[model samples]
Target chain A: MTGAVMNPAWALLAPVVLGVLALAGAALNGVFVARAEGRPALSGAARPVLEVMRLMRQRRRVTVAADRLLWRIGGMALLVIALLKTAVIPLGPWILADISVGIVWFNAMDVMVWAGMWLIGWGANSAHALAGGYRFLAQAVSYELPLMFALVTPAVAAHSLRVSEVVDAQQDLWFVVWMPVAFLVFCGSVLAFSAWGPFATAAGADIAGGILTEVSGVDRLLIMAGRYALLATGAAFAVALFLGGGSGPLLPDWLWTIVKTLVLLAGFIAVSRRLSAIRPDRLAEVAWIVVLPLALLQTLVVSIIVAVRG
Target chain B: MLSIIVFSALAIIAVASGIAVFRVDSMARATYALAVSFVAVGVMLVMFDLDYIGVITILMMVMEMAIMAIYMIMFMGMNPALMPMSMVHNNRWSAILATGIFLLLAAGALLVPWPARSGTAAPDLTVAVGEALMGSKMLVMLTVSPILFATIVAALVLANPRGRYDRWGDNLKRVCPDDPQQGGLGK
Candidate 1:
């Protein structure tokens, strides 16, 4: 069905699908984090993976030298900033539940990630933690450019920074098809931005667990959850931009949207599983040398195509 | 019904994950929850007739968190997932502050004077949005690409640790004498 044809059934299915995919994504992401930490996925008696949260909350440990107040604030801020970013997301037809600046708002929210991370790393009062925080700035600076280019490709094609408009633009053709190069670049940036595999050096366990090393108690919880939210948010954009929001043949619009989202998320999980963690220096290399050029080419190509087609 | 379903789904995930961001016991878990919450919110954006923004929300958050999680592991020198750590601090004040902010925002939402719908929601809001963006804000579209390209080149120049000497020999035919591998030329 075309965008002109509104299917309510699909709408219902979309959220449900998104919810399931989200849960799965979370589970998968958690599994990877567990693996990287050198814990068994599932162990006898303890269910090693499941024991993760249980162990974290069981006792609170804060480094003696860390600043208690900033440490705690940093933790809470991590989640809050993530949520703030979400406030502007356009789900389906309900724009005003809290919708504002669409994609721009989401980009603005990213600043929170830097702020919260720096605070947590600084508050931890450890050299490694500080270094991780410092490296984050470097990594952030490198990847963010490509990420932004990838993001704008869709906006350029759809003619709007507003995500809803971009999805609507897919009515005739999914942006992914029109701008295949941009879609790949965007996906790559998402993976890098999330630090899923190749670009995970900033917080490498060897370096410090970098930022969160000294954090403990409820503070750790906040930081971790914030990271998950970031992943979920990133996955949502993948679905919206490349896959086309809620588009399917038999399924309701929403359901189709959800299915697409989960499918993309599965890829995220799969990639997360297969790739080795990237060191900070290497992340910079890939982001600058590889991702950057590709993104530039993508934007240029998409613009030319749009110009020619229009 | 559609609105309710969409709003509720986005709100639940967004808020739950928002809360979870601080509620989880470890740094990694918190990051994941935050990402999920943001994804939910992005979905909501799609529902809101703001497709462009909604998709962006998802894309931006995922990359940001992945990086954050890795940094958590590397710098900490511990398996971030396995190591149990406290994630909360300033419980009483934070709770109070968060709650107070929530209430204030809620009140503003409820009390604010909302604008009336003008000209029956654009037949296709996306098209309208696209036209407005490209027609009026074309400069952003024009400028962003080049700026991004420059940034990429600058990043490359700044980040690399080695140069041609690090890879090739002085003669450009044979491998360098200081090569670490036994057969530098792959012979």
Candidate 2:
């Protein structure tokens, strides 16, 4: 694979591309929901558009003594953070920032979600929202370390933190083939951070929507879109970091990137739909005791291989 | 010109939000205001071309503040944190101490005779930074990190109210450890 192409003009396209991908993911999720209900798949696929329109027309809800400033910031930050994450991700050869610490940059952006989700919970001055926020943090503490090690595996194997270099290093064999444990952990972390699948307890119905309990209209719209966007971005980054990015037959590099992202994203949505939500307190033990060690061992194995090759 | 403008703007933001941390009445606001200040400083670090340090600073600081906010709210007496309570305490000494330290730092920054750039920068500053900081001390760092981690684990274990004895019967014959909350793993 060739080196990344840097152009400021391409930066403007990042959000537009992410939005489309997010929309597609949402539609896939809608289709899954419809299928479960024994309804037509096509109508379920169109549900996101309808939901967007319905939400646009819905009135904004305000709770008593809400911290409007922090609440609005929290609501809006997710989509913005998702957009920021895409800056470091290269679509085939085209990239926006191409910073030296692309992997860390992505990590930093995801970390912002902790603040955003919490603020959404805290700003409402409601019990459920606050409980939801705390749940997210609890879940985050478990997934984050394993995720960090998973991220480090590729960077260590490539001997560089640069995302493009990671893609280039995979010309021989994809990191996913050797680092399956890390990839699985990374995918699980993505789901956890996005608050999808078993990690959706933060917004679980038990807490009356948790962080989403009080949001309405545009605020609700933004948070929902942001979740899907985050899922899409995570899938895209997984492609670049593990799957040989844009390395495929017939299709162009950029198309390959999109194809891989969508496929993985659909898999995520389907798997999340199939699984039940795991309580944060219960998840803590399994994540630390089981997942963390496996991820660490995977990294250790990758490190040994890299050292031996050298 | 653009770089200078951006730097100045970030400096102003850092200072302003640092002040906001003290001034804000709400605990969440105060915590996030401090976060904003650190993020601005982290951005400034990026401007200085320490991309790894800068980004890591942002990541670590934000995560810390998020957890801190929870502890602040949880521990604050009578739930004053939820209410619009005064963020400051022992105002007089704190103000004096803050002013004194700020002045001392400012004075040191201005008075210190800084060394001039003697050679061109390394091609990869991240690698250069790692080598400069860790080359000779790699063994020490590697050893120290595990010791620190073990210390933390030991501390938590000591401080924990519930231990194996508390969970299981003293005879250790129970099939399941009796607990108020069930863990994901059946054991």
Candidate 3:
């Protein structure tokens, strides 16, 4: 009876607890990032997007020109897709829906970010919103290449697209230690994907809050919440990919896992803040020509290293 | 029971937001709606027992949206969700393609023969995952780190119009307040 009872429960424990913890990790990471950059820290950095949601709930204003349906859809889609990707990630020993092509699936789901943003911008019908939408396409085009390359590097090195396999491959040596260059590139891409500073060309004050300018009330809140959750998730990937994910001394596997995730997130926020003064166009250019090539080179080096070691 | 409740709630939220992805009026609203949908999905995935994947889903999407929003603000110079614009330029074709793809994917999901467990499961899944990573796959990751650094440099070179000298003045001696000829931020 105990065996049967424990089995399912144990199976469930890994996914759910770690999932929540991972969410928590991103917030913690952002807080550290903010603090490192001499910005104000809050308990809510553990949940950086609460303010946006609060603001949203407080109002429900809509411009007359916006497409009613698409406007509502954009915010909603962003959050759901972000969450769906998390279902495949493995924390410590637990995973849900571990597909053979888990990596590809994860990437495919992420493309929704691009689609949703475009829809949002186009639907809003405002000139500025349209421009912001176009900027997203441009930035996505540039950063995605390097990001994909960086993501594939791990699969190539591991000889499997399964994230679990990729993680398994890292036991002897954290990929970050061995492939420092790839690590850096992956980190950069994560930042780009997250729209952290230096690369935050789209949504700053200069852009009048970017694509979200027209959004008021609860819709705005949902989007903001989605952003925080996304931030947390991205940071967790960094931990999983390069860092020896959840590998540490003494602490329970879950606690260590959270700690590692927070560290990566802090690093991202710090980088984002550091690049605050830089222009977005400059950032985009660097991501494409420079970062992409470096990522390719990193892949080559890893292939060579594996070839020689094998 | 708690797990069931949590997951059910998450699933409902995810599905609701997923619908909203296409239901909203403005671009910004759609973005937010989609974000909420993803968050709910991520949470639901956590309930599904894939912590790493679920967490990453949240992180990657957040950053992606942030960049998207940044672009929206910078270029549009207005709120993206407030205006009524036609996002579905080629609606009929897109619908057909989307439906076709969904059907094919669903078919695969249902029909494909999945691999059964071959070996005994590891007691500690995390450690097992760790072993697989370092045991063989470290090389691929090894190569990509420098690629990221190079990207940083390239972004700087391509994006910035001026160099260090432009900002600091010619001699690095003083700020030229009157210099309208600055190339980068200094100008």
Q: Runs in model 1 with CA error above 4 Å? A: A1-23, A29-56, A96-101, B1-187
Highest lDDT, which number? 2
Residue A300 of model 3: what lDDT? 91
Count clashes in each candidate, considering only residues at least 3 apart in sequence or on different chains: 116, 0, 131
Taking chain B only, the TM-score of every model is 0.61, 0.79, 0.71
- Candidate 2 runs further than 4 Å off: A1-5, B103-157, B168-174, B178-180
Q: Using TM-score as the measure, what is the rank order of every candidate, best first?
A: 2, 3, 1
lDDT of 3 at B13: 86
| Residue A66 error, candidate 3, Å | 1.3
lDDT of 2 by residue, B1-187 (tens): 9999999999999999999988888888999999999999999999998889999999999999999998888787586588987788998998899899999999999999999999999999879999999999999999999999999999999999998887888987778888888887756
lDDT, candidate 3, residue A164? 72
Report the candidate with higher TM-score, 1 versus 2.
2
> Per-residue lDDT of A84-142 in model 2, one digit per residue for the tens?
99988879987787788999999999999999999998889899999999999999999
Selected candidate, larger lDDT, 2 vs 3: 2
In terms of TM-score, the best-performing candidate is 2
TM-scores of all candidate predictions against the true structure = 0.58, 0.93, 0.59
Per-residue CA lDDT of model 1 for B1-187, tens digit only, reads 9799879978987998898877766666677678778878887987877765776777678657756765675665355443556678778998899899999999999999999978677898769999987988788889999999999988997787654556566656654434444231233
